[model samples]
Target: MRRTILSSILVMLAGFAHAQTPECDRLCSRDFMFSLDSGLDVMPLVADGEHANGHMEDGRTPLIWAALDPDDEDAIVFTSTLLFAGGDVFAQDSKRGMTPLHWHLFRVGGPMKEVVAMYLGEGASVISKDNFGYSVLDIVNGVATAELYEVYELPYVNDEVADMIRGWAELEERWKDAFGMHLGRDPTSVRYFEVLAEEGYIPAMYAYASVLEKPKVEGFTPDIEQALYWYEEAASVGEVNSIFHVGSSAYSGTDTIEQNDAMAHEWLSLGARHGDTNSQSLLGLMYANGKGVERDIQKGLMWMIISLRFGEDTPDRVRLIDEMSSALSYQEVKEAEQMAKDCIINFFEHC
Candidate 1:
């Protein structure tokens, strides 16, 4: 009878495990991007479930899985997708206090260099202490032996790479100090920004573009195509600043991108919806002048008004608002104001 009861308990446990598979599999799957991009609604995962960041009990996320999965190709794309789809890159393991950055740093070579750089661009800390209170700099510094590299599956890399990996913390520190922890100037540092940008770092894309756009007359000719490519790449991940940059650039056709009003309108509208002040402000003016969209004076004022809430008041903006105010009736202005309120209230979901 006891044997039969044990058998029944085992079957029930197995059934419970099978039943729990769908949600976990959908989220923690190595190819989660494939499923997510294929129409899986991300709301359910982020709504009540903590799957993306995982909890203290698991210390696992799609990024951790993808990073460890030796078979997963183009894991960077998947990682970027996770960030875009609302995965928390800064999520610390409740028990270990380690981050995705720590995990990637624990295995530094091959695609890892760029992957970790992308995380750094996304604001992952390089010096945070773990559960054992050891930072990556403390643990991995001067510890690059053959067995260590082999453990991380980096047999192809040479001994010189040890210096490269060990010295990376200092280089990263210099890169950060060069920019005051931001993306501006000091283009000579962080030569890997383009690689990280290609691996889906929005800021790196913007930074790499800045590096290209910097005024230089020797050794490197600024490629506008490359600049536009990074801008568009950054824009793809809904980086508001990148969206504005791309939209503004697209709107003003130069020797680079031929002016496409429809495309400009589309990109700017996306930027505006995503709550970028520059985009909202530009979209307001665009709608007012019908530059890239149909002339809707009230609609223009609506977005311009929204932009004002987040940005500094400027003379040009004030003058434009005054002009639009004179052009609009009281009722029309009130309606636009209400519409702006509704846009905010809806969290831009229906905006």
Candidate 2:
């Protein structure tokens, strides 16, 4: 990585440092597109960097390239210039029918909010369909659609993103040392986590967020807002543990985030599908009381029963079940019991 940046620097240095240089005429004429991964500041070469809207070999524009990066603050600044210079937020390349949003959502990398806001606030639609009829949320299996719940979040699973989540889990195992190992710990380990978090790695996002919640190191202040923000990052990518936290924590309310039942339900529903009986228990009661969703005694009873089978039949849960059962007809109780069996059999299939 260092070598590539050094080479690009040398190439850029070889040219005269004027307002605009023909140095790129010979050096960069081969490729008009530049990426954060390119590791070189090409801002000097582009005309005001705003008109630097060149496509790469993959047909991706400069904006698409900039979205994939997490570390290059300059790339984000350059993207702002490109946008002001009449850059289209909705520009799609023929390859995979992707926009810059697609690149940002899928790739690992920094300064995510600045880039996301520029496109979103400029009327970029999260609902835009790709060639495959997949929305941005659908492409990632609806993991990060919490923010988009009003327009709605995608739920269909994407195998590629699932595999990526698995890989992140494995990488996390390797970086366990990065958790609290500061100066007394491995500095490289800490850097690895920070880099990955900045790059939008979900697990790393969660880990880093959790750390910020209550800094393990002395003198570092806790930051719940920062913690929740990162948890959202992890939850957006379908991280199961993150889903649990996103739902439960929001529902319970904390100093970091407000109590939001709707957001809680959305996240908990995702968790329940993943066989989270705790979520099922909450949903069971919520449905009974119409806390976030509409009141449905049948659904409430059904979810409660499912929790029972999952070893969550505590005294309160049992009493709630009994109370609801009393209000239900014998046939209704039987139907809800059957629904629980079916849901458990298929891990909440058709749930």
Candidate 3:
């Protein structure tokens, strides 16, 4: 009985030793909080709501620390492991509701894209609102970096955030000019578009195309071909406006290209199918007039009704839809209108 008891004691000791091994407590350290360069392996520290290394000074996680230093490899790894172990990526500090994502976006420089991507992929909510009600998208869009544009292109974000990013990319030049002068920089000739385009910014490419196509001074002419080329580049990256512009340019015979309604219809239809209200409205007009597809009043009414449902507060589109509805029989118009209402309800409810 004594020998059996001794064997049991040895087994328990061995298990405890194994459980507390270096690999098991990889991120368990006292000094990890202050030092961003600590090459501490963090995979072993499972995030179970208990501070892994007693590192929470005022309830801040190691992830928050990592997010503050954009280039800290150890910090990144530590945060990644914490997220993997079910750390709340959206957890707020005691002072504010800033999530790890907000910190990484606003603090980190260029390489923060990968870190942001990692958190997003792990189900970090981009819509997590801060104390001031600003979301991660708001924080990211506030930063004027080509790197931020690259982060915005990740497919994990929702359409709303993506649209905001695209709008910022389009207006980056205007923003730079307005703010650049305060920084003692040349405001009018900033190459922000070029830098962002080189970083694979689809919206920047589209904006560059617009600049290229704009009327030039008396000594120079707008480079239509180059504009078309950049538009094509933007379209290749799934930019809806770029697709719309390309189709419109082709139909209008701009840039010395022959007008081709059939090709225009193809691209416009493609954009409409991808949820572009502008493309939908244009395609509806074409169908109504028999300019592209066969004139099917029913199909035209359907597309127009759908576009009106999703379109912005545009008086012209509203007036056009009303006019088009007037041409339909009472029953047809009522049915189309009901369908549009149902679509709106279903979209909001499901989305």
Candidate 4:
């Protein structure tokens, strides 16, 4: 009788342990309706990081998981419940420090936009900074939805919050102007670009230079002088793309500025040293052709190979690399390829 009682007690204890093991996982796997109704009971389970949530997997909470699946109605409800239950909407992922709002803003074209608005309406903090000191507004500013500013405007907030919101709005406007150029909307976008440039937005200065470089219409009636002015302005701000363009323009005489290969070589060298692939490729061409400087086959091959390492591997780059490889011994080409791979690996590892 005593032995049987002890055996029964042990079995009950074992069953209790098994039941507690997946508490968090079970809560997370519950249907969205169940979670919404359970509220605080489910909250403790998520806080412990034992189950999968909307964006979170393995050990992530429902809040993170919901941000990634904004289109799912269940995800939306789960997120709303979590927020109402005092879940940290601004909490970051362990690896990337990305908040829920950050992911939502990045996915603006879809149902995520409405979800983002919902969070903001529920007092979800947008001004929370990431590891890099960038807010959600900052990350999304130049990439998507100028409407973010309007959505984020909250009334009667403190001075600090108000200031942050205003800054985000300004960045959104500047980014709109910058995006317009890429969409081929209008040259008038350059006017806004100039304004942002005057306000010390360095990227805007670069955009203005790009607009100036091309002709307004199809004719040879080029504005080389104006183009040079904007390019120099952008280069003065240390814009890498601007530096390359200015260098190339100086090397090849436009209608206004007389060709000076020496000046071109100088600017191109600056850009290449700064790691601008376009400038590096152009510099390699100059060396290969013996246009401005004395020809050295070895030096030319080295620069061309360097350019190939940095340049995009489009058809043009592939053809250039193949043609340049023909001039070098097999060993040099092999070494260059290895160096390029190493550079790529290092780039991603740090990034």
Candidate 5:
């Protein structure tokens, strides 16, 4: 799924570059030029030192051209060969001042992930911007959407590319400070999350809220009000975990906040509708017990079954399922199963 989206974006970027094949210069061989132009595996040809570092009339080196090729597999070998033969990793085109690393980011192959990493390993600069003042990070951030970032949910993104983006973000002290505490588990750097949260960084908002709600560091006490405030801030930005946490809090009630079943139902219903299984399970329990809304065992069973389908099987869910199943008639169970299936297929609309 991610690869498909990435390929579409890369095609657009490749078109944006609109590069024409360059006439081979005095330094480049026709054979080597053909190898690059045809997107062939370049290892065997570039192994010799003759044309490895050769450039075209546009000042684009063999390395830069390798980066622009649409085929990811051959591009990797092509990049590796040229770099091994001492191709300039920092080589930029005369027209745009874009580095090989920059062009490589637009390559369509998913495996080209390796090429990006290789550039970084060879000390290609992420800070290097093109003529448009767009750094490698800028290009990535501008192209990648929330769906891309949520792939594995590390910090800014999920995969190796995400680590690269985080490295770029770390160039700023505030990000470094926040990530240092959040990821490094350094209690002393906790305040940095507040700094970033104040700046409206959504992840930092979630982190800050968690710390306030349940401080692990010494010399800190839980502050439900502030915690709820930050959680609300993150929730406003569509941070699903924050939505779940807020619902969980309202359901159980904290030191200063009174239990409000209606508010709990409202928040949890929203979270459940958003496909949060935790919310689904809790909402199911509420419906089963008639704590907030009127009791409807079939709806409760539907939610519980759907939660188990999408989320991990917790002891609570397992035990609840067993109890609910035993009490439900066989027809009720089948009806609930069908309802869960419909809810999933219809994306929770009217579920």
Candidate 6:
């Protein structure tokens, strides 16, 4: 095993050595793209100073290429790796003068907010514009519609991407309006949210469903049917919170939602992989108790440890930890802990 591991390391080092150039054009090389798409560590290619920010012939950096493909299964992993390796989030392509964030918004999609948030967190400027004078906010706030697309001579946007951008803007507006109304104690806040939810705004669907599930206001009764409907709706769109709610409800068999351990396992697995701590905790319980799936103590304990690391501690959680810890051998506990650490490092994708 040691020999095999050493051989693998040597092979990777050989490839990395072959890929590097003195001038550092590795970021845009075909080999680099292959490495990124294959989930090989491209960090080696960028580890040398300034290579992470290097551009191609078209003046597009690796980050820009990654941003252009939000739909790719490997995009997020590659994008995050590039960012971690110090890819300049503000790097603008030569032709479009669009930053990574701007290029991200210029695509056709159903909101890549996680990727957008990552760029924003790294200080990507939202006000930055393209050569056509369109800001990131302009595209995302509904200002860059089909009419403006024509006016700006952005023929590359086409009808589909323009419609998607318009939809994104509408969703943003609905989210802001609904949030403001709710905070201001407006009586029609729920109705407003319901309208947005019906329009397929995911956050509104979750909010509306939450209100129906448990009415904090006086004079409103619980509507289990509508709550479950919206919860399921939002979950279908990969809304993490709604996925947790639906999974939890399905596991515990709510008034309207039936008890189906299989459905609970499926949904909670999705939620857990999306980094929902509650989902992780519940999935741990499921694995530990063999509730919906086969029992696996180490897998269960790993998730419990992960949940405790990322979430606030509770009495039930502590007790579960103690119980699971007592049941596992020392080696089992150590392995489980290592698994939890790796799971977190991989952004829960491997978990």
Local accuracy of candidate 2 as per-residue lDDT tens digits, 1-351: 000000011112222122122234433442545443442244333322222245556565544554333344554554443432234556775666667666555433312555554554343545567665665645555544434322233333346544543454445444555654653644354456667777655557766776677566555567777777777777665455667777776677766567899988988887767555566667677787787888998888887665553232345555667888778899998888777656654446697
Top candidate when judged by TM-score against the true structure: 6
How many residue pairs clash (N, CA or C atoms closer than 3 angstroms) in each of the candidate models, in the order given? 0, 5, 0, 6, 0, 0
Candidate lDDT values, in order: 0.53, 0.55, 0.50, 0.50, 0.59, 0.62
* Model 3: residues with Cα > 4 Å off, grouped in runs: 1-192, 215-221, 251-258, 313-316, 330-351
Off by over 4 Å in 1: 1-190, 213-217
Using lDDT, give the best candidate's number. Answer: 6
RMSD of 1: 16.3
TM-score of 2: 0.45
Cα error, residue 7 of model 2, in Å, equals 65
Question: Model 5: which residue pairs collide?
Answer: none
Candidate 3: residue pairs that collide: none
Q: What's the TM for model 4?
A: 0.44
How many steric overlaps does candidate 1 have?
A: 0
Give lDDT tens digits, candidate 1, residues 1-351. Answer: 000000000000011111121233343222333234311233233322233444423444443443443333344444443442334556666546666655554443433455544555454555566665666555445333434323543223334433544455554554455455334434354456666566554556777776665533244557777777777777766666667766776788655556777877888888877666677777877888888678998888777666553344556556667787679998987777766656643434465
Identify the superior model by TM-score, candidate 5 or candidate 6. 6
Positional deviation of residue 350's Cα in model 5 after best superposition, in angstroms: 2.0
lDDT of 5 by residue, 278-299 (tens): 7887888788778789998778
- Pairing residues by index, what is the TM-score of model 5? 0.50
For model 6, the local distance difference test gives 0.62
Task: Tell me the lDDT of model 1 at 67.
Answer: 42
Error of 4 at 32 (Å): 36
| Model 3: per-residue Cα lDDT over 1-351, one tens digit each | 000000000000011111221233333333433433422222232221123223344445554643343455555544544343324555676445666666665443333445555554343556556666666665545533334334543224445545644454445444445334424533233256555666665456766676567632233357788877887777665466777776765556665455789988877776655445566667777776787679855556666655543244256555666666667898986665554434333331221
Show model 5 residue runs off by greater than 4 Å: 1-176, 182-191, 214-223, 314-316
Error of 5 at 63 (Å): 35
